[model samples]
Target: MNLIEKAASRINQGDALSADTAALRSQASPADEPPHAPLVQRAQARAAEVPVHAEAPSAESEQEIAERHVSRQITIDLERLRAAGMITPDDDKHQLAEEFRLVKRPLITNAVEATSSDRNRNLIMVTSSLPGEGKSFCSLNLAISIAMERDRRVMLVDADVARPSLLGYLGLQAERGLMDLLLDPNLQMSDVLLRTNIDKLSILPAGRGHKHATEFLASESMSNLLDEMANRYPDRIIIFDSPPLLVTSEARELAAHVGQVVMVVESGRTSQDAVKEALRQLEGCDIVNLLMNKGSSTPLDGYGYGYGYGYGYGYGRSGRS
Candidate 1:
């Protein structure tokens, strides 16, 4: 008999396949080899032992599993951040930290006093007119500053789908995140949301790229996701590191969902015309703030870092928007 016939005959006789059967199969001629059909039938028979409608895991249990998955903490290198002139929780006294403090105040206030009409005030996007203008840097520092709040938590999302840099700044490897969440309805926020060594701070990488990324950002799915992030926790703030307005349509689409926009301008390098064009793209947003980075202002404490803050018309040397 052929291998399939022998195996099926043994199974029908309520006998397990012996080592002899395995040896026989190994030595069998090509024509004597078992077809896959019987093996599939055997698998089906085994699977029939289990009920088709097994009880689903409870919501609480699923949440626990998600929490366990998100508990893997991403440790930010504080020394690296210090050397890069970024904010660290331990260095609240640094000039950059203080500058970010002024930058984050109005954002926090708007988030706290959000009316029903301003439902998404807590969702902020940091962008610039052109590349290399320090939007990512400002986004990182702003998120860190907000995370340092006593009662507030922050989720920093890298929305610059074209080129992701937040993870590089934090010294983290890219993994499944925002794009995955949008593409797969099966993915839970906890499956990709990363907790960090910094208390009250979490991160969502840009995830994989897609050709329709701008469409995805402008989709109803993204709006729903933003709503969930905004209302999930009363004390949480989400910061999006967006693409440059003049360079990509992604930022404008993303701006439609956020209540506030912080446009980072390189003081001397970014011309007034460039800032105006960038601001024009954000005219749909009610709260647009300007942050001037790498300005002509003298370095603070001789640390080679300077910051200046102003409202709609004023521009300073240090970073502010």
Candidate 2:
């Protein structure tokens, strides 16, 4: 019998395949009597257990997906997450809001918790080992988080010269940014810094793309710019959204100036070796912490035939509390 038939027979006999198990075994063989039918049935059976209200398999507009993502953010709660060990009790989102006041409040809590400390490491840079690892998302949230800190000024700089993303993420105008400041060393800091809607938070966007972007960041002007910002705003936190280490040398150069580097690793996508190599490549700054996104599909998985998080099932927020 084919794998699906084998699986069905096994299930009927009260020995079902694990839901979390890999699906590669179910791929149909060339000699199968009905090529894709059995595999489809197996996929259906597996999908039935999850109860997801997914979109039909069809092309979707990018705007629709972006809207859906933004809507999902409203449901994430601090107390619920803390119970799941996703965040600490004291570091819960609500508790953090009380301590810090800033616009786009959720981003701030995500940053503070991921970094795990408020003292010492405030000039933050959020980056990844490679592209599409959620570095921009991490950087934006961190800047928002530091701004939320009561009576603190925060500046979010879009320093990803190669490919700037913060403007698009925030849906902001791409007119002027850090590139302008670098090109015109005489430009006053106030001219380049754009204050966001968030109280006490400012942004220095990637002003304009230039051929010598890497050399610009590596220059003495870069050091002077950072030093000027540091001295000008003593209590404010500066967050630099830099390019991924493996993708470019921007992260290494920026890390040298920042107080701490918070590396973002997409839970399922980021390889352990890539993470180790990224750390090795940029060897000096304090690695503030590692933020594992989409953290652990099943935290209790991998142990052979053992009970899961809550009595062989997942835990609710109430259970977590």
- TM-score each candidate: 0.73, 0.57
Residue 19, candidate 1: alpha-carbon lDDT: 10
**109 in model 2: Cα distance from truth in Å?**
14
Q: Which residue pairs show collisions in model 2?
A: 100-148, 100-150, 101-148, 108-145, 177-207, 178-207
True-structure RMSD for candidate 1: 25.2
For candidate 1, write residues 63-182 as lDDT tens digits: 333353444577889998887767899999776677677778878987898788775888999888898877787788889999998888788999988898889877778887888889
Best by TM-score: 1
Among all candidates shown, the one with the greatest lDDT: 1
Cα lDDT over the full model 1 = 0.70
Q: lDDT of all predictions, in order shown?
A: 0.70, 0.53
Candidate 2: 10-residue stretch with minimal lDDT: 24-33
